[model samples]
Target: MSSPTPSTLRVGRRYRAKRLNGPYDAIVIGSGIGGLTAAACLSKMGKKVVVFEQHYTAGGFTHSYDRNGYEWDVGVHYIGDMGADHTMAKRLFDHVTDGELKWAPMDANYDRLFIGDRQIDLMAGPKAFVDSLKNDFPDEHQAIDSYMGYLNQVAKALPGVTLAKVLPNLLAGPFRRLANRKAPAFLNRPTQEVLEGLTGNQELIAALTGQWGDNGLVPTESSFIIHSLIARHYLYGGYYPVGGASEMAKTIIPVIQQSGGEVFTYADVKEILVEKGRAVGVLMADGETVRAPAVISNAGVYNTFGPLLADNAPHKAFYQMKLGNVQRSMASVCLYIGIQDTAENLQLPKTNFWIYPGTDHANQVDNFLKAPDEHDIPLTYISFPSAKDPSFAARYPGRATVEIVAPGPFEWYADWADKPWGKRGDDYEAKKEAYSQRLLEKLYEKMPQLRGKVDYYELSTPLSTDYFCRYSTGEIYGLDHNPERFEQDWLKPKTRIPGLYLTGQDVMTCGVVGAMVGGLLTTVAISGLKGLPLAKKMFVG
Candidate 1:
C-alpha cells in the first residue's frame, strides 16, 4: 500500500483535484445497501459523510441495470416483510425517508416449489402457509403441527440470537451481559439437526426446508437461526419495488445529499489508510486520497480485511486464518431474456419458482455444487420483473422480461478471474452460450410459449460476479450460511482496526432484507443510541 499518486479524484464530498480539504465526519467505502443505509442514518443525524463505490452504481448486489431496454435486478429476487408494519425492512426504509419509496407486493403465494413432480405453493401469512402444507401431508398433520411449533420457537428466537452475534465487543459493557447472550445455545446445531429433531417424515422436512437454496445451504449445513429468520420473514409477506431494484439506491441518495453527504459510483477504494491503528481514510483507484474521522465499509468481510486493508494494521495472521475458514455463498448463472408477449398469455406467475431434483435437501446442495443440470437444476429462482413492476413493461413496450437463476459452480470459470469482464475469450463465450441455451431449454420446459419469444438472452457466471463485485471467486452473497460460518465470531461488522467497519451481507445474514438490516445495525453502532432516531421512534411508535 502506497500513498495515492494523484490522478484519481472522484468524490461525494467536496474535494480539489488530488486533495481532500480535511476530514469528514465519516467516509464509507462501497455504496452497498448496508453502507448506504448507515450513511443515510448518520446523515439524518446531521453528519457530514461521503460514500465511495467502485462500481458504476450503488446498491451492491441489489443494484440493477438497463440491458436492451429491460431493467433487471442483479441479486434481488424477492424481499420479505415490506407490506406489513413492525418489520425492520418497513421501518428502516419508511423512517429513513419517511415513506417515499413505493413497494410492489409479490403474489400471495410467495414461492412455488416444484419438488419431484408436485407444485407446492408456500402461501403468505403464518396460518395460511401452515394450512397449505398440511394439505400436502394429511397423514403427518400432527407431526407437521409439531414442526411448525419448532419453527415458531426458532423464528421468535432469532433476534435473541443477535445478542450472541454482537456481544463479543460488549465484553467491557457489563458482566451481567453474559445473561443477554442467547444465540450460542442454537449455534452449535445445524438446520437438519434441529428439523430432524422435530419430525421423522422426510417429505415434510423437505417441504419445510425447501427454500434452503435461498440461503445457499443444505438443511444439514445451514444454521437453525438462518432458517428461522428467513422462514419467519416470508411467512408474513414478500415484495419487490415498483420501479425496479435501482429505485432503492436512487430514492436514498437524496437523504444522503440533503445532510451534506453523497454516494458516488466509479469511486474505487484501493486501500484503507490507517493512522496509529485506526482507519482514517482510503486511497482510491484513480490515485486520490481522502481522509475522514471514521470509516465504514460495505465490502464483504474477506475483501475488506484480506485484500483492501491487508497492510493497514496488525492481526495479519488472524485475518488470514478467519479467511480460510469462511466460505462464500453460491454464485448464480442467471438467464435473463426479453420476451415479446404478456405473461398472462404465457401463464407466468409472479411467484418465484423453486425447482428441486428430489425431496432430499442434501442432494440439492450436492447438485448445486456441480453446476446447472437438466434434472436437478436444484433451484430455479425465476422472476417476472415486468409483471411485478409495470414500469418495466412500459420501458420495453409489448415485451416482458424473464430472469431465470440457478447455481453456477466456481470452478466453471477459474481461468478468467484476472481477465476483463465479458471478454473471456472465444472458448469461454462459447461455453457460456451453450450453458445459456441449456438453461433456456429447461426454461422452455416450464414455459413452452417462451420458446421463440426471446429477443435477448444472456447468462452470468460466478466469474462475472467476481469481476464486478471484486470478491476473490465471485461468491455472490458473501459467505455461505453454513452453521460454522454463522458462529465464527470473527466475521462481525466491527474490525480489530479501531476506526474501520464492515457491512453488506457478510455483516449480518444473507438476503436483501438481511443486508439492509445489517446496515441498520452498523449505523446503530456508529451513531450509538443517542443518535438513532428510528430506533427510539420504532420502539416508542
Candidate 2:
C-alpha cells in the first residue's frame, strides 16, 4: 500500500487574523452548501458577506478529498432533479454558482436495491419508474400509482411549509394552519404508515422504501414528508457534478468574491458574541473578534445552540430546552477504495447499489444495532464516483474510485472519541480494519472483478465525520427526520435572538438541496422585502 499524501483538492483561501477584510455586512459561521448559498445570494444583493469554515477545504459534505493518487467525495454521491433547468433545485444551484456548475446524468436505472436474494431497479422518469415496478409486481399496480400520488401531494404542500419557515411569527401560525388544511392527511405521518395504507404487500413496501438510508431513517420512524421529498427529488434520475463534488465550492466561491465577500478555510469560530441581547459578531479561536451586524450559523442546531452560543445569551435557555425535542441522525462508516485501472477498464457502473439483508428494513436495522456481528449487515451502499463524473478520468488518468457506506453507530467508537484523528491507536485501527474488510467483501460479492484490483482502501468511522465535519456525534444528516421532528416550528431561518439566524439541514430537511433551501430561506428572512425579487427568481422561476 502507498503512504498517505496531502490532498490537492483544497478550494478556499486560508483564514488568518491578518487576512480579515472587515466591515462585513453579515458573518456566516460555516461554508456548507447552506452557508455558501446564502453568501452568494447576499453577494448578488450587494452585501459584503464573510464565511468561515473550520475545515481545510470548503463545501462541507460536498467537498472531495484526495490521497495516494485517488480522490473520493465524502458525502455527495448522486443528486436528482437536475436534468431540467426549471427545477427549484437546479435553479437554486445555478443561482448560487452563477450557472457555472454543471451536472452529468446517471443511467436511467439510477438506484438498484437488493433485498436478500431479490433485486429491484428504480428507473428515472415518473412513467418509467412506475412501469418498472409494475413489471416486477404486476398485481399491485394501484399501490404503485397511489405511492406516486403521495409523492406529488407532498411536493404540492412543500412550498407552503417552506413559506411558513420564512414568514413572520405572527403570520406563520395562520399560514401553517391553512397549509395543513389543504395538505393530504398523510403528509407528516410515519412513512411506513402511509405506505401500508396504500399496500399490504411487504415486498412492495420494502422496494418503495429501499432508499430510506438517503434520509438516515427507516420507513417506520421517518416522516412521510422527508421520505416523499427524497423519493420525488430523485424521480427524474441522479446527476453527478460535472467536475466533481468540489466543483460546488469552486464555482460558488467566485460569486461570493465577486462582491468583496470571501469564504475562508481553517477559520475556527470559538463563540458567537452576544451583547445588549443581540448577536454582534463572533470570537475566533485565535482570540480575534470579527464583528458584523448579522450572525448566521450553518453549524447545525446542536453546535449553534450548545457550543457556539454563550450560556447567558438571550433565548439560549429556550433553544437548549427545544433541543430535547429532536434526536441526532444516524452516523456511518465509509470505506473509500482506489483502483489503478480506469473506471471504463474496470467496468464500473454509474448506478448506485443499495444492498439489504431482507425486506423488513426497520426490524433489520433494529437487530443490527442490537448485535451488529450476529445479524447480516442491514445496508451497504456503493457508489462509483469515477464513473459518474465525466471529468474524473482526465483529472486522474488510469484511476477509479469506489465508496461503500454502512451504519457505524457512534457508541461503537465512543471509547476512542478523545483521540486525535489519524493517530487513534492500534486498537482503534484494528476495529476499523475489521469493518473495512467486511465492507470490501460486500463490494467484491457484487462485483467480483474488482476483488484483487483494489489498489488501496481506507475505512473512516464516525470519528472521521466528527473530526472533519464537526458533527459531534458524527451524525451525517443533522437531525433525525422522524414524525415528531416536523412539528417543531422553531426550526426555521430566523431565531428568537435579534440578528441571529440558522441555516443548513437542521433548519429544513437533509440533503444538499434541502440545505440549499435552508440557505435560500435565510437570505429571504434576512433581506425581508429587498429579497422578494431573489426569492421570486429561485422559487417562482
Candidate 3:
C-alpha cells in the first residue's frame, strides 16, 4: 500500500467527551442521510438534537473521500425526482438543506443496460422512455404502456403506505388494510412474475428490470413494490448534487446547529442506555454517557438490535425472532478509478451503465454465488461521477473519476474481518487485486479507446464497508427488498420501547431519498402534533 494520503475532506466537528453539550432533546446515532434529516427537521421544530457518526465524516453512504489526489463518493451515484421543485424529494431536500444545496441534471439517456450482447437505453421523461422501449420492442408497446400505468398506480398508493408507518397503532392497522385493498394485487409479488404476466417477451422483461442492482436484488427475488418505486423515481431522469454528495451533510448540519444541535464524527456509540425498559441516552465508546429525552437509531436494524441494545431487554427476544425472518442485503465491491484528464477531455458521458451476463438475472446470481470463482460476474454497474456533477472541474482541475460496483458476499472476505483496513496481509491484497482486474476488464470492454490511460485505481471490498460503515456483514442496502421483508409491521419508525425510534434504509426502503424519507417519518413519529404542520407542507400541501 502507498503512504497514507490524508483526507482534508472532513465535514462534522471531531467528537470529544468534553465537547458534548448536555440536556439535548434527542440523540441520533449515525449521520447518514436519514439521521441528518431527522436531526435537521427536529431542529426546525425547536428541539436540540445531537447526531453521532462512527466514521471520520458525516453523510454516511453519501460521504466523499479525497485520496491519491482524487475524490470519490461512497454510495451516491445518481438520484431521481430532483429535476422538478414540486417533487417530494426536492421539497424534503430544500427543507432540510435550507435551499442551499443544488442539483445538476444528467443526460436525457440516463441509463444504458447491456444484457449479454444486446443494449437498451432508458431515456428521461415518460414519452421518451416509452418511445425508447417501443422503438426497441415494437411488438410490446402495449406492455410498455401498461408498465408505466402500473408505476403511476404505485405513485398514487405510496403516500398512504408511507403515512401508515408513522401513524398511531389503532389508525395504522386499518390504514394498512385499506392500502392493501386499494393497491394492485401484484404489489408484493416478484418483479419477474408481474412483468412476465404483462408481456411474454423475455427480452422486454430483462430490459425493464435491468436496474435490479439498484435495489441489490434480482427480478425474481425482489418485490414489485420496490421495483415500481425505483422505476418511477428515475422516470424523470437522474440528478446529482451540484457540489457532490458530501454537500448533503454540509448543508444540513447548519440546520442542526441552529437549534443548539451538533453532528459529531468519530463518536463511537457503545450501547443505548435503557432504564426501566426505556432508552434514555447512549453510552459512548470513550466511557462517557450523554443523556437525551429521545434516542433515534439510524445505524440499521441488525446493528440497533444486535449490538446497541441490551440482551436482557423485554423486546430483545421478539426483535431477534423478527431478525430471523429477513436476511441482509447484498454486499458489494467498488473499484474507484482516477484519470489525469478532465471529464470533457475523456469524453465521459453523464450516464450510468448496468452490465449483465445474461437476461436471466436470478439464475446468473445463483450460479455465481454457488461458485463465485468459477462463474461469471452477475452484474456490474459503472458510474462516471466527474461527468455527472457540474462542479467537479472546479474542485479538482484536470481530473476525472469513475466507480464500478459489483456483488461481493461477506464470506469472501470473512478471514480478513479482524485485520485493520489498508494493513491486510498479502493474501487479502491478492484477492482484491484479482477482483479489481476483472472489474477493470469489464470497463475496458465497453470503452476500449483508453485501454492504458488509467492513472490510479483501488478496489474496496466488503471488509472495507464493515470497517468504515460498521455494517457487520458489509450489507450495503440494509435489509433485503424481498416480499417478506416489507411485510414486517415492526419495521416502522416507532419502536415498542418507550423513547427509542428507528430510521434509515432499514425502516423504509433503500436509497438516498428513501433513507431521508425514513428520517422525516421518524421526526413525525416522535413529534406527533408538533410535526403535523411540517408534514402538511411536505405531504399534503
Candidate 4:
C-alpha cells in the first residue's frame, strides 16, 4: 500500500494573532455545525462574528479527510429531510449556506438491517417504511402503524420542546406545561419500553429500533424522543451533501466571511474569560485574549463547563453538579477502506448497512462490553461514501471508499490515552489492527467481492477521536441520549452567566440536524426579540 499524503481538504483560515479582526459582535468557540450555524445566522443579522476551531480543519465532525488516495467523512453519513424545501432542517441549512450547499438522495431503500439471519430494508417514505416491515412480519401490521403514528406525534411536539429552549424560563414554563399535557405519555420514556407497549414481537421491535446505533444507545436506554426524532428525520430517505460532508463548513464559512467574520482553524481556546459575572471573551492557548460582547460555546457541555471555564468562574460549581446528571455517549472505532476501483465498477450500494448479532440489542451491547473479544460484535454500521456522493468519482477518479463503525468503549484504549496520536506504541497498533481485521471480516461477509479488492485501510479508535476532536472520552455524540438526558431543562442555549451560551448536540439531541437546531436556538436566545423574525422563518416556515 502507498503512504498517505497531506490532505488538501483543509477548510477555514489558520489561526494567528495578527489575523484577529477584533471588537467582534460575538465569538464562537468551536466550528461544529452548531457554532457555524449560530455564527452564520448572527452574520445574517448583521452581527460580525468570529469562530475558533482547535482542529487542523473546521466543521467538527462534518469535516472529511483524505489519505493515500481516498476520502471519508468523520461524522456525517446520511441526512434526511433534505429532499424537500419545506422541512425546517432544509430551510435552516439553506439559510446558513445561502443555498450553496446541495444534496443528493440515496437509494429508496436507504438503510438495510441484518439482524441475525433476517434481512430487513427500511424503504423511504412513510408508506414504504411501514409496508417494508409489514411485509417481513405479516402479523405485526397494527404495531408498525402505531409506531409510525408515534413518530408523527413526536414531530408535532418537537416545536414546543424547541420553543422551551429559546424562551425565557418564566415564559417557557407555560409552554412546557402545555406540551407535557398534549404530548403522548411515551414521548420521553425509554425507547424499548414505548415499543414494547405497542407490540410484543421481539423481531418486529428489533426491526423498529434497528437504527439505534444512530443515537449511540440501545432501545432500552435511549429516550423515545431521540428514537422518534431520528426515525422521523429519515422517514422520507437519506441524502448526502452534493460534494461531501466538508461542504457544510465550506459553504457556511463564505457566509460568515461575507459579513466580515472569519472561522479560524488551529484556534485553541484555553479558557472562557469571565468578568463581573459575565462572559467577556476567550483566552487563547497562545495567551492572547479576544473579546466579544457574547461568547457561544459549540464545544460539548463537559468541555465547556470543565476545562473551558475557570474553576472560580461564576456558576461553574452549579454546572459541575448538573453535569453529573448526564452520561457521555458511546465511542466507536471506524475502519476507512480504500479500493482501487470506481464505485460503479465495484457495485457499491448507496444504502447504509446495520449488522447486529441478534434481536436483543440491549443484551448484545451489554454482553459485548463485558467481553469484547468473546462476544459477538453488537453492531456494525457500514456506509458507502464514494457510492453516495456523486462528485466522489470526479474528485478522486477510479477510487471508492467504505467506512465501517462499531461500538468501542473508551476503556478498551484508556492505557494509550496519554500517548501521542501517531506514536501510541506497537501495542496500540496491534490492538487497532486486530479490531480492523475483525471489522473487515464483517464487511467481507456482506460483500465478499471486495475482500482482496481493498487497496488500503486504517482503523481509528476512541483515542483518535480524542486527539482530533478533543472529546476526552472519545464519544461521538456529545452526551448520551438517555431518558434522563431529555428531562434536563438546563441543557438549553442560555446559561446563568450573562454573556455565555451553549450550542451543539449537548444543547438538544445528537445528529447534524439536532445540533443545528441547538445553534438556531442559541441565536434566538442571544438576539432576543430581534431574532423573532429569523426563528419564525426557520421554525414556522
Clashing pairs in 2: none
Minimum summed lDDT over a 10-residue window in model 3 is located at: 1-10
For candidate 1, lDDT tens digit of each residue in 9-91?
12233333344434578898887778888888878878877888777667777787666655567877778878876766788
Compose the digit string of candidate 4's lDDT tens values, residues 1-541: 3433545789999999999987899999999999999999999999999999999999999999988888999999999999999999999999999999999999999999999999999999988988888899999988888888888889888888888998898988888899989988898999999999989999999998999999998999999999999999999999999889999999999999888999999999999999999999999999999999999999999999999999999999999999999999999999999999999999999999999989999899999999888998999999999999999988888899999999998999999999988999999999999999999999999999998999999999999999888899899998999989988889999999999999999999899999999999999999999999999999889
Position 72, candidate 3: lDDT: 92
Taking every candidate in turn, the Cα RMSD to the unseen true structure, in Å, is 5.3, 1.4, 1.7, 1.3
C-alpha-based local distance difference test score of model 2 = 0.94
Off by over 4 Å in 2: 1-7
User: In model 4, which range of ten residues has the least summed lDDT?
Assistant: 1-10
Residue pairs in steric clash, candidate 4? none
The TM-score obtained by model 4 is 0.99
Tens-place lDDT per residue, model 3, 384-407, is: 999999988888888889999999
| Number of the candidate with higher lDDT, 2 or 3 | 2
TM agreement with the true structure for every prediction: 0.91, 0.99, 0.98, 0.99
Model 1 alpha-carbon drift over 4 Å, by segment: 1-22, 164-188, 310-312, 367-375, 531-533, 536-541
In order, the Cα lDDT scores of the candidates are 0.73, 0.94, 0.92, 0.94
Candidate 2 structure, TM-score to reference? 0.99
